[model samples]
Each structure stands twice: as C-alpha cells, then as structure tokens.
Target: MPSSKKKSSAKKSATKPLLISAGAVLAAITLGIVSWQATAPAGTGSSGAPAVAGPRTDPAAELKALARRESGDKLAVGRADAPVVLIEYSDFKCGYCGKFARDTEPELVKKYVADGTLRIEWRNFPIFGTESEAAARAAWAAGQQDRFDAFHAAAYAAGSKEKGFAEHRLVELAREAGVPDLERFTADMAGGPAAAALKKDQEEGYRIGVTSTPSFLLNGRPIAGAQPLDTFTAAIARAKAEAAQR
Candidate 1:
C-alpha cells in the first residue's frame, strides 16, 4: 500500500509540469491572435489582415487614361471633312517652334488652312520638362477664355524676340495679351482644362515618337525635325495630290 501511494504521488507531480507547459503555449497563442487583430487594417472581413495590392505595372494603360482625361472638347479648325490634315506638334519653349510661329505658321494659316485646302490642328508637345508643360497648360487656360492664339503668339514672341521663355514671363505675356482675368487664368492653369489638354497632347506626341519640337504630321505620316518652309510646301502639295488620288 505504501509503494502504490508513492507511485501515485510521482504521477501527479509529472502531470502538473505537463499541464503548466500546455497552458503556457495556449496563452502565447491567444496573445498573438489579439495583437494581430488590434493592428490589422479595417474592413478586413477575416480576423487577420488582407494582403495589399502592388503598384500598377502597365504603362500603356496609364498613358491611355491620361489621354482620355485630357482631351476636353478638343476642337478641329478648317473644313470638317478636309482631305489633308496638318497636325503640328509644337513646343511652347522650343526655339524652332517660335520660328515657325513667326514665319511658317502665319503662311500656313493664311495660305493653306484659311483657304480650306488643309485642316490645321495644333498639339502641344511639352518635352522640355516642367517649364514647357507649364507653358502649354497656361496656353490651354488662355484658350478657355478664347485667347489661345493671342497667348500663344505672345508667349512664342517672348521666347523669340526678348529672351528664353520663363514661367513668370509667360504670366506677364498672358496679362499683356489681354487675358481678361489673370488670376483666373493662373488658377485654371493650376487645375483645369488647360492642364488636362496639355497632358493629352504630351501623351499623343509620345505615342507617335515625337521627341523634338515643331514636328509636323501629314495625316499620320510624321515629318521629323523643325523642317523648312519648302519642306512644308512640298508636304502640302503631296497631301493635296494624295487627296486628289483618293
């Protein structure tokens, strides 16, 4: 009887340690679960957290979205059904573009576009970084107030005649060109139609491999560089010939 009692006491002592170890493991698990629940993001249906989404990996989709958002009531001047379309990819900060604005654009506008022989569309390709983009946006804002051509002429003239165009200088030009409300113009540039339109132009230019300013596209055929007047004349002639053939 004494031996049996001693054995039973030993068994009880062993069982106590096992029970303590199991309880400790269970307590640790409970604390871990509580901590996870406290720190997880809200709206997670489960007790634990959901994984976060990665960054957008499609560049083409992003550009398409930008183009869609930026093309706000974009206009087409000249005959609606004109056979030859002259798409001019111009940069506000580009010297060559300034030259064209001075010499080529007026001739083209007066001779071809105004005469209804060609459709002229201006796309702003602001490739000279932030300042170019800003200038283009400001011009777009000026357009909102029906002063685009005037603002464009002044800004390009400022770059050509006086000095390289600056942001402050463009603002001055806007004011001088009789933009009714300078403050509203500036604010529109900050966040309105102008910004969106410029972005659209930038995207279209990128997609079409326009890396430089004052490039022209006859229909969809690109004319690289700031080509001469003769080149433009030839292109116009070719476009007219093609239209006749079609």
Candidate 2:
C-alpha cells in the first residue's frame, strides 16, 4: 500500500472476528470501510485515476482504548501522556514497514515526539512466517534490556531483512543493537515471556481486522499502509485538536 508497485502482505488468521461488544463491532466495521481507501494504490482511485482526499470520519473510541499508555513501555517513544498516540501494527519482515522506519518515522520523532505531542507505540504483528515470529520475539527480548529502539533501528535498517532472521542472525542483531548481556538476550528471546508478548500483539491486530502489514491507528482513526508524511502530519494535527476538545 506504500505505492502502486508495493502491496502489504495479507495476514493469514483462521479465527473469526472477535467483536464481543457493540463498540468493537463498530470499530471493525469502521476499519473495514476505510481500509479499502487507505490501501488503494497510490495515485489511483476506485476508477483507476488519481484519487482525492475524502471527508474525514470520527475516531472510534474502542480503537482509541487500544493504546497502551504505560509509562514504562520500552517499545514506545515520547511521553506516555502525549495528546496523540499512533499505534502501529507492523511486521518486522514488511518492506513498507522498513521504509517507514527509515524514512518517515524519524521525522515524526523529531517534529512531534520531541514535544510531547505524539506517542508512537509498536505492535509486532508478524504474519510473514517463522522468521517474522522469531524477529518479534527477539524484539521483545531486546526491550527487556531497554534496547528495543536500538534493536528496531538495526533490524529495519536498509537491506537488513535480506538476511533471514534465523537464531544466529538474531544474535548478531542483538550484538549490533548493543544488548549488553548476550547470554541473557538469547535466553529471553527463547523464553515464554517473549512468546506471550508476541501473542498479545498478534491477537490485538487480528481483533481489529488488521489484514495487512504496517496498519496503523492514529488516535483511533485507521490508517493503512505507508502513506506519505503529510497524511500522518494532518492526522496528528486533527487528533491533537480533538484531544484538546475532550
């Protein structure tokens, strides 16, 4: 969804939709409607021509509650109390996700995260394969040592995914990220906590009907794919204004 040439990987979940409440059902329906527009090939509309922006929709309250604003969350950046929270459901093996990490995210961090205006939270929704799951676990393990950000940057660096995320490769990444305790890193990566954390993220993504990689929720407004920087900036501005009203 980043470009006409690039498309997101579809998640293969066998489970049915987990809409237990009216709010959850509405959230799912809202995402289902907007997701098509959000993932429409860049520069093209349903009629196969350049697309124009559509009227914005109200944020879904149920989705907004998905933001885990824990002050000590290691996989997040910026103040926990930031007015706008961008929750990203992404796979480590997703090329578009890497593009966002390399190109767009740093700018957002510089412009918004630095000022306590936006908080970006990471959700490891690994749908690619075993390697993706391994990488997610490894990332959670890195967070244990307060090195999640460094590890994330390293893992998403240019051409990093070309090398598969095998056990040895994960160890190499841990070293590159400067995780001080190699023995502990390996233990944590293979431990139960890492698996549980990965499951929690994956389940949340599935429940929200996130069918593709790099899906995002900006203050409860669904934004699919790796959209341009301006799209995110405008959404952040709107969310911030709405937060002020509340």
Cα lDDT over the full model 1: 0.65
Using TM-score, give the best candidate's number: 2
Worst 10 residues of 2 by lDDT: 11-20
Q: What tens-digit string does per-residue lDDT give for candidate 2 at 1-246? A: 455333222321333322123345446647754574466578774336675566434336557867889999988999999999999888889898998899889999999999999999999999999999999999999999999999999999999999989999999999999999989999999999999999988877776587776788898777777877998999999999999998
Model 1, runs deviating above 4 Å: 1-76, 158-167
Model 2's C-alpha root-mean-square deviation from the true structure amounts to 12.7
Report, for every candidate in turn, its global Cα lDDT versus the true structure: 0.65, 0.84
Candidate 1: tens digits of C-alpha lDDT, residues 129-226: 77788778887777777777888788877444355556677778788778899888888888956766777776666543455667666654556555
**What RMSD does each model have against the real structure?**
26.1, 12.7
Provide the clashing-pair count of each candidate structure.
Answer: 0, 0
- Each model's TM-score? 0.65, 0.78
Q: How close is candidate 1 to the true structure, as a TM-score?
A: 0.65
Model 1: residue 80 alpha-carbon error in angstroms: 2.9
Clashing pairs in 1: none
Residues forming the 10-long window of minimal summed lDDT in candidate 1 = 61-70
| lDDT of model number 2 | 0.84
